[model samples]
Target chain A: MPGQTTASLPRVAITTGEPAGIGPELTLMLAMQAATLPAQVVAIGDPDLLSSRARSLALDIDIVPCRPGDDLPAPQAGRLSVWPVSLRAPSLAGTLDPANGAYVLDTLDLAIAACRHGQASAMVTAPLHKGAIIDGGHPGFTGHTEYLRDACGVDEVVMMLATDQALHGVAHGDTSCPLRVALATTHLPLRDVADALTAERLERILRVLDGDLKRHFGIVSPRILVCGLNPHAGEGGHLGREEIEVIEPTLNRLRTEGLDLTGPLPADTLFTPRHLATADAVLAMYHDQGLPVLKYAGFGRGANITLGLPLVRTSVDHGTALDLAGKGTADPGSLRVAVSLAADMARHGQ
Target chain B: MSQAQPCIALTLGDPAGIGPELVAKLLEQRDVVGKANIVVVGDRWVWEEGQRVAGIHHEIPEISSLAEARDQTGPVLLPTSTIKPEDVEYARINGLCGTSVLEVLKLCMDGASAGQVDAICFAPLNKLSMKQGGLKHEDELHFFVDHLKVETPVCEFNTLGNLWTSRISSHIPLAEAASHVTSERILSATQLIHDALIAAGIEQPRIGVAALNPHAGEGGTCGREEIDIIAPAIDACRDAGYAAQGPFPADTIFRRARDGEFDGVVTMYHDQGQIALKLMGFERGVTVQGGLPIPITTPAHGTAFDIAGKGRANVEAMRHAFDIACRMGRHHASR
Candidate 1:
């Protein structure tokens, strides 16, 4: 709503992640109230999985099967347009099926194609099982971000998580409500964090983070607060020299390009209101440095946004949540927020 | 103590700042007074100035020297008064104020050494002011070690309520922090914290040792320090009949520690746990000088020179420091 100046509803592709996971179930819930969405949603998954999940959830929703070439119909309550991808096996509740992993990857592939070709304005994804995908013989499958990056053929990308709940719903039409935290190094050991962070890598992340926040989130000038790799931001080179050696130089270089970047500040005090008052986003040196605090603040209602993607992409901040998969206990708040944010970003891009 | 009540030696650390006032405010609570027999070590002028600044007019019994001190509910003030309120500025650093702190520390340590008091808890002390006053002690722990003259592995442990954190390599460069993360250091820090937690009254202290590398070095892909150093230290500590666990990723473990998952966390470096601990409880933190002859504690916060004599300082940390001192005092006495 912040950047939507269009008359027509934006078309979005929602990929139902691992069929054995809660992704299929959450997709069904979204389809139940499809009419209320600001964007026209075309779900990418097996139609049979959707029908089964809807039946299990006891949701009365109509599945309209379609493909990329078809003219999409107007959205209404209890109506879901599906880009059918058949599952290798029937997915049961609270169970993992590695055989159907290719089906999950197939959905992402179709959604990525639609978003890439401008057939869909953006893509929203549910949680997928990485282990199951690997078991399905896709060796060294990292995550959704890597899969999308490889598919898009882009070299650099940034992963960011955000939530606007703490803004007290005051960001109604304003985009400055959410606290976005991007990581410099993800899924690396604490020891490798010091070495993995290079000036060039840091600049690349900042450039991507800066460009996407403006183009996608509708921010004119993004003020990013950068966290130091070491505690106290190296305490002026006593704790660690990553700030002085790598982060500071990169940030300084980025600032010369007219990016309003602040910090190498202490991660401990950075999350407080004193620093976050004017921040558009925070760039942390590692996963835990920024995430523990952000997850603490936005745990239940957070969305994971993949910056630097050619098209807008948003995801639920949570994982497959296997235990709550078929039990109807999995929270849909994050997925709902992700879809809403994706719609806004898509509209803004237009 | 052999006596019915435990006598504690309390010091008003820095006269120019909030320590005096916090002590005065702490004294106004009758529960604190009844818990231990507190003999305050400072100049009468400073104590009275603290009373006037904090707006408390409690009638405290004063004694002139350590020889005259006694165990009682009433605060026995050993007058080390050298700097008067008129001579020293309220917030400005004064040599006489710092000298008075060192003077009182000597008296209290002597009393503690001679078994005159069960434990010692000083209000926040300004190290800079102490340095400005010609005091050459590097830190309070070093000063206590020289005074106690006992050879034992000593370190600083920070605690917020029930949670405690001990570090292996403190006040070192983060780059160098990894190189110093040896098995011996981790074992020592874990043991110290374990012993301290026991002294603080946890029978079997569950101590979580943090990993030097993130996610415990991700099985050596990230860094081999955790595989090489931290894990072995933890295994050694466990083998020694201690409940030391982890080498957990620093970020996630702090949450677990705060949620009462572990009694103490042995960290790799200073800020690894500090950033989390301080953010979790800024005002309610206490610093315990572990591995010493007597239990020594002070407010985790330093002298608030910015907000000094206006009597608006939050005493939550000071109060906890007092509480830890009392609790550890009883435990240390029987040991």
Candidate 2:
């Protein structure tokens, strides 16, 4: 506790995502047990929604109202600080409404603004309903990472998921460190993944991944394991030629530039402990190739971090469980880990 | 099976690969003897080579025939072919090694058909060698389907502990994977895994179907494959009286299955399930040749030609494959 004084704790802005979903309750759950974390979390959503959810969940967290740049107090048990953004319409648990779409984006904007203005060290987001947001107005909204990338005016950002839990692969033995999986292509259809993985894009993604592992995660020279775009990594051009034509050349180029990168290896064999034990992270060709293993290894406890951003940001690895909204049954494990990771990243960046 | 000890035929998979060492290591285990009445159905010289390379030995009773193996309680070697160990190469794709491997597997299949053996489990085999050895089919699953001579539908089911996965498409380009995600294929895959689960002793297996697109097509915004293809197939599967859910996102379906939300997963592509299953438990994964009349299983890995003769092969998957064969053999016997 000597080193973890109030002044030393990083301030993390927690955006309570979809109002009708589990975000409000998960935020309250995290705030109720906030004393255990290394950061001071400020919830950036409607205060009325928080209070109502708290009452409904029977959590006795005292909602202390504050602004983003206000001198934040140290986290205490049963006390939570809030930077309130008013909701357009009242929301009920497990119900979706069109009016609250802009409110969700408003909360994210405030969190981004806080992080950019140095008012907060990092931001952790709860899950928001993409459908509700689209129905509420903006049809082009894909995900929080893209929205943040556009809001921050960055050309690229890497989506990396990590958990500190060791992958005891039952029989392949254990990984010594956390399993981190980053995607070269995030949310594309299966058919488009091959075309999306150009050499130029791969080089840029690798640079972002390598640079962020240094600048944010404190890894000096991160070792990355990359997966091939095809099955058996094209089986030496018999299955598909992306590995030979694209992934191999790109990795070789990056290696010449003195980045520690390994393989255009088979995706099926890439996630095992033998390959994972010494590596810092795995760069998969597509979303499903990397994340299924990452999510399986660290389900409900993994935190998703956006790399190459101007400010540190982390989020829960799950979607908003509308059915569990206001029921006090949502798991706060991922959110807590996200907050802790953001705090660590913030401190590491300093 | 009537004597409460189901007989199983085991083969040293590609002789040049780690299969021999793995089988040798497996024979050295004490618990394996009590699990099944195993008869090593490969050449005696190759078996000896495996034992020598693995630095372990067990005195398995040598028998000239399968009938002789049935009378013994402990493991026995049938000695199908005799080839000098010096003539064989380790890890390379040789036609002779592949032909010998196939001959041994064929003997086991014939044994199962003739009621001499209840199930079959082999060590890791090399597909390239098998291809060189005149394996006309895509892989062994097709060979099994063809040899068994009767098939409604069949697929390779990769199991890691209680969670099992069957993909609708495998070994093809990822570009062509989307084309194979038709309702007919999904239903067949769903039905195949369901019946296989039942045969393996799980009654009423709950199968979770995976979407081909990322984020499950995002309600038709990102891709419509989930809405137009996967979801309809899931509906068709349900209508056919199978307990299946999803068109869930491929990335999270395995996680839910791992957590026991479902007993099996039907993946739309090869790596969707493979990436997760191998990551979860690589050394313990078992590949079951689903829809065959007889229970057949092998390690869900290939011959580690790189570490073949070094005797560094992990025999965990081999042991698990044997255990699964035993479980399924009991069910097959009862049926």
Candidate 3:
């Protein structure tokens, strides 16, 4: 109790993603139990929507309103700080309203602006529907990831997913770990994954991943295992030349720059305990190559972190659940972990 | 099965490896003994040596010929060939050991073709020596295909727990993985695995097909192979009287499979399913040579050259391989 109100706690801004989706409901659910977290959380959205979702879900969170320039209160039991950004339209549960698309972007922009301006130490986002945002007339909106990249004005950013948990696989005597997969490429066509995978691109991803693992995760000499583009990591170029040519040369260059990188190993065999023993994270060449195992191992209980951004940012790994928006049946585990991880990085990543 | 229990040909894959020891240990189980009448095809001396290393003293009745092996079997260890322990090197891949492996495989094939054995189960074989011994086939699947001399399609299926995965392209470059994801290839793989499931005793095995791209192409924005190639293949399979679904995202389908929603999966590439399956259960996985004329299965793992004679090898995969062989043997025999 003595150190409860200390200045050491980081202030993290939480963006309620798409208003028509479960973002508002998830925000209400997580904020009701915010006192246990390592930092104070400020929900950046309409206070009316938060109160309405809380009333519908029977969540007992006292919503304290804060203006842009007002003094923020420390997070406490049964309370969450609200930075009231007005909604473009009244958002209803289980519905899609493209009219509120600009409002969703507005919340993300404010949160990013707060983190960049040092008003909040970090930002955590809930799920937002890309279709609704596009219908609402925002062009070229791939997702929050690309949006965040554009917002941060960074040439490249790494997308990584991690969870500090494990599950024993019954049939195989297999076990899971806090495995992380940082992707070199995301959302490209299957035809394009090969051409998109180049030495220059791989080096940029490794640089961001390595720097963040040190700056945020506190790994002094981060040992990153890289996955080859092929099934057996090209099986010595029989499967693909990218590993022997592109990935190998890039990793060689990175090794001289003082980062401990292992592999271009077979993606199939790289997830086992033998390879994961001395590694901090796995740098997967593409999306499906890495995510399936990570998601299966994590069992839907993990957070996605944006590495290489100037500001600390973490978000729910799942997308917007439009169907379960009003039912209050959605699991808030990912959002909770996302917030906790953001706070952890905010406290330590400085 | 009541008319006559299935007679299975069990070969010692690489005597230098753990095949001999695994068969010796596996036969000690009552369930295995009662499940089928087995014709154990291997070098008796190699098996005897395995008995010495594995410390099992169970006496197996030996037979002189494959003809005698057919009619008189409670459990007969048929000596297809002989290799003395003094001459054979432990855990080393040599031309001699490779020849023995190929010989046992051929003997098993002969039994299956002559209808002497209903199915075949063998231990892990190393390709290096198989090549040195003049095995021109790149993979055993190719060897099996060439040896059988049939025009039927065939592929190697990697299985764990109750789930099976058939890849559209295997042992190929990831860069070339996309071009191979055509509708014809998908249909062929689906049909092969579907038929393999039927042979393994599933009346109508539900198969979940995986997408090549991250989010199943995120509706062609990420990759169009799912919409253009995989979806049509599933439709074709459905129209052709098979129960198949997907082009589902590769990442989440395993979760569904583990939850018992489907019995098998057809993956786009090797690691799409391998990463999840191996991570879920590496030791228990079994590799079944699907779409072959005769039912054949082996332990998904390779010869543990590291722990060859130390008696440290876990027989879980071997037991599963034996179980699948017996089940599939009975099913194939019944049909």
Worst 10 residues of 2 chain A by lDDT: A168-177
Candidate 2's displacement at residue B110, Å, is: 5.4
Q: Count the backbone clashes (under 3 Å) in each candidate.
A: 3, 1, 3
Q: Write the per-residue lDDT of candidate 1 for residues B90-158, one digit (tens) a residue.
A: 777777777777778877888888877778899987665666676665466777788888697888898
Model 2, residue A320: distance off in Å is 3.4
Residue pairs with backbone atoms closer than 3 Å in model 2 (clashes): B16-B91
* Model 3, global lDDT: 0.81
Residue range A74-180, candidate 3, lDDT tens digits = 66777878988888888888788899889999999999888887889999999888898999998778789889999889999999987656434222111222566
Q: Is candidate 2 or candidate 3 better by TM-score?
A: 3
Q: Which runs of model 3 end up more than 4 angstroms from their true locations? A: A1-6, A67-71, A169-177, A256-258, A298-300, B1-3, B15-18, B39-53, B57-64, B71-100, B127-135, B305-309
For candidate 3, write residues B171-282 as lDDT tens digits.
6776777898888778888888888877666888898888888788888778777887789889998998778899789878998888888888888877887888778877
Q: TM-score of the A chain in candidate 2?
A: 0.95
Best by TM-score: 3
Instruction: List per-candidate RMSD values in Å.
Output: 4.8, 3.6, 3.5
Model 3 reaches an interface RMSD of 1.5
- A152, model 3: CA deviation in Å? 2.4
Candidate 2 chain B: worst-modelled 10 consecutive residues by lDDT: B80-89
lDDT score of residue B197 within candidate 3: 78
Top-scoring candidate (lDDT):
2
Q: Candidate 3 chain A, which ten residues in sequence have the lowest lDDT sum? A: A168-177
Q: Candidate 2: DockQ?
A: 0.66
